[model samples]
Target chain A: MKRIFTPAFLLLTAQSFAQDIKPEMADSFRSSGKIYVVVCVAAIVLTGLLVYLITIDRKVSKLERDLKSLDKTSN
Target chain B: MNIKKNWWKAITCVLLFYTVIEGFLGAVPARDILNETIRNLYFHVPMWFGMMTLLFISVIYGIKHLHNGAMRSDLIAREAAHTGVIMGVLGLITGSLWARYTWGTWWTQDTKLNGAAITMLIYFAYFILRGSVEDEQKRARLSAVYSIFAFVMMIVFVMILPRMEDSLHPGNGGNPAFSKYDLDSKMRLVFYPAVLGWVLLGVWIMSVRIRIASISEALLNHSDTHPTS
Candidate 1:
């Protein structure tokens, strides 16, 4: 299969390079695109925490709804 | 800035923004193995600091629960411990990643690492102990009692035992700590704010959980009084 590299993918690839203050110091990570892997891993960790927080938030919102219904019934 | 409701939260947001931007962009010491990985200090080490602060808050609430027999205190303690455990796990993951990059190993039998694992184990047991009891008051009292004991053990394992050994981590076996080594002024600026940001975030999570728990308990009480409700 001939793979067509879209502009979006190419942009991502370009930005994946190391944000090195010393360009000479980051020979491998910059050239080999390894820094993006670290960025991706960090993003995954943050996403996991965010998902957990969202789940809890939704659960609380649901319970609050249930409580509101119970209040109506009691009234 | 409303100090009671939103000030700290706003500060947390700003600090976190600064941490994410400056943490990556900031200059770090060019050392041998930890050349670039030193930046992990902002993320990994702050997790430990935030976890420690949350756990300390948990123990304080535990003590308060025991003293006043306040169920709210117990709820806060439980939620704080829960959030602290999550933060601690994150710290362990980040530390492991940093270690793998710097030391060529994901895990080591280092005293500090072992202490961290043991401390995590103790807190995990605390949650399990909370789950074992169905009765509310009994659960609260026993959990409070055990939390105090677990915290003391945690202090011994994490603080004392690690110091008694030669650690690859900083500030062990008479080695100078981070401040003495590479915690230069530039790093400190981001590092302190990162710690505060994470700890505030932990507290925010705990507060939200506590609110939900209280509401659920209220609902349960209402149902007990009115069968239809």
Candidate 2:
């Protein structure tokens, strides 16, 4: 919740200094709050996937050790 | 599983990055109710597509298991089915959120939504069925058969039944699908790649899971042979 508001709040506050968007132009709502919603969802999903990849990497390393031990015993 | 890894993962990453930046930042059909919420289609719809594709692949692998009797095939099928469910859950969550804003309800008694829930429930049962059996080979065989049957039922729920009844979803009853919604070429450009990116990412995750399963199976075999000193 904080993450969502912080950026938007900052944008809202910083809107005056940001002269590039145009003085008479874009409406405050059209500045894309809904887009932020999409971004938040995407970020959450990607973070979850990244954590999953870390787990898989650890499992693969453990399996490699197990295989190494088995080969040593055979020798 | 043999062969050097190439650019596919790289492509998946790039495509997804493009989808996110382009999907949200890009312009959309600004109609009443839909407004900017239409952007959810790129993320939410692709999740369903990826889940369906993985489920289809899992069923294929399940059939292959029946024919060849390899534990590897069964493992692949299981991993695919399990990983596919992750995407299905994501789809359901995003869809529900999108629905809440658009339809004034987080859920409805719509036929398409009900069918989707049933599809998810059927896959959850697949995992539970996998867990119940004690014998390895018997579990493999039964899981394979169940997955194949489940896949057919999934088609019924996901594809056929919804079309036959009224649905709050598109492409059902008289509602317009993405095609009929005047999804211009610009949106299609991002939407298509978004689907491909998600499906490829599912493949990547499932492949990693299968690799781990294979390794664990090998370790089990090693212990059985030598009694792990």
The candidate scoring highest on TM-score is 2
Q: Is the docking of candidate 1 incorrect, acceptable, medium or high quality?
A: incorrect
Q: Tell how far residue B219 is off in model 2, in angstroms.
A: 1.2
Please write out the lDDT profile of model 1 over residues A1-75, one tens digit for every residue: 003323433444355454444322443443455545655566566657756765776677687888888788787
Write the residue-wise lDDT of candidate 2 on B1-229 in tens digits: 1225636866777788788877866655545677667778788999999999999999999999999999888998999999899999999999999999989999999988988899999999999999999998999999999998899998999899988887889888778776854358778888899999989888888877887887888877877877845
TM-score of 1: 0.79
Interface RMSD of 1: 4.8
Compared with the true structure, what per-residue lDDT tens digits does model 1 show for residues B194-224?
Answer: 8888788788787777888789778777878
Please state the error at residue B55 of candidate 2 in Å.
Answer: 0.7
Report per-candidate TM-score of chain A alone.
0.59, 0.55
lDDT of 2 at B113: 91
